[model samples]
Target: MRGPVRWVLWDVKDTLLKVRRSVGEQYCSEASRLGLELPPSQVEAAFKQAYRRQSKLYPNYGTAQGLGGHRWWVAVVKDTFSQCGVKDGATLEKLSYNLYHNFKNAENWEVFPDSERTLRSCTDMGLKLGVVSNFDNRLEGILRACGLLSHFSFLVTSEGAKVAKPDAAIFHQALQRCGDPASSVAHVGDHYVNDYLTARSLGLLGLLLDREGSTLHLDDVPARHRLSSLDELPALLQKRAEGG
Candidate 1:
């Protein structure tokens, strides 16, 4: 039989918190401050394109290529604005730099309504919490700024661990830190592959947080393993503890 969950690993982005404004809106707002006029829709489309290209070119913040997180993001921001027809190099540099630092602060992010209550419930249940995110080193500061850092026992980032999700190494790093068996831990995140399947493959209970029912058509995701919000978590754990 599986052991009762003693530890819970969380995914930060989209799961616990998200940007206060859409990337396009934020980018356009920043660009406007630098005297560039661009529609939010156009910037958003360009951002999607630039982000895809950057991810393809420099996967996982380009750590292997030595670009590192900051430079990788700077390149993405530059490409995003460049695609939107901003030709001034100084403007691109200033915009990218501003955006990079802007996201590091709490004003740029908002915690999901269900996040803190669920976290507190988990803590009350005696479960140890830790973060396993594909984010960079700025995560601790961001979490701290949001007043959520104290809830976690430890924070592991792709930049710090040198590994990202969908790869088991980062999860292993978190497991090592918690010193718990995979069967005794549960990982929750919004991605079907990165959060659920990957963790399940490593023998940890994987809970997919499908807030929008995006994965409802997937036969691989059953009702028992999927959550529409973090609010469902504590009850699910209670059920699992009761061998349901």
Candidate 2:
């Protein structure tokens, strides 16, 4: 059946792939190898603190092309380790590089159970697909390694767009590449602000894939726009087409 959505834009990471290891767990492992004995929980806490600080310091950081991406992550890693009591400059540098490099491998991630089937079904229904992500250039390598790069015709990363979601620039860039009207596009992502509301504000259908059903109390999002998984997507699109 025909659908109102002509294009489906995806958000990578938790939306499509579940990162098998937490960043803190991975960082703690790396630190242990370097003789640092930080608690995993402490490392996780530090990582979050550092991440928030870094994000503020460098809004739309890693999405930039070239060395800016590398530098941005290096700063984050440095701050993360700093929080864990690793105060040496050279050690922080080595750890940051290794962590960044390690994430390029697909083994560290797992595709969501409904991801492939949903992508295939959408493609079969003639809807074009793309990705709009706040991630950096490493996303392409990670997606290709995970066997998902081919499913998307294009991806606009924060590095590539010079901006991240919750900002209209990235969405506009994706729309330009897909060459579709905003009304014909729907973006599926886990973040209520970055993924759902931002796309909706831009005139695209923004569906929240609330796999954890964590935000039921939020009154701003309609029940119809909330999805537990991509499995319900095609049926929902059909309903939208029928003006439900």
TM-scores of the candidates in the order shown: 0.95, 0.91
Winning model by lDDT:
1
For residue 211, model 2's alpha carbon misses the true position, in angstroms, by 1.1
In candidate 2, stretches whose alpha carbon ends up further than 4 angstroms from where it belongs are 1-3, 62-67, 242-244
Q: What overall lDDT goes with each candidate model? A: 0.93, 0.88
Query: How would you encode candidate 2's per-residue C-alpha lDDT over 79-187 as one tens digit per residue?
Result: 8888778899999989999888888888789899899999999888888999999898889999989999999999899887888888998999999998878989999
Clash count, candidate 2: 3
Q: Once superposed on the true structure, which residue ranges of model 1 sit more than 4 Å away at CA?
A: none
Report the C-alpha lDDT of model 1 over 1-244, residue by residue, as the tens digit. 8979999999999999999999889888888888888999999999999889988998888888888889999999999888878889988899999999989889899999999999999999999999999998889999999989999999999988888989999999999999989999999999989999999999999999999999999998889999998999999998888888
* Location of the lowest summed lDDT over 10 successive residues in candidate 1: 28-37
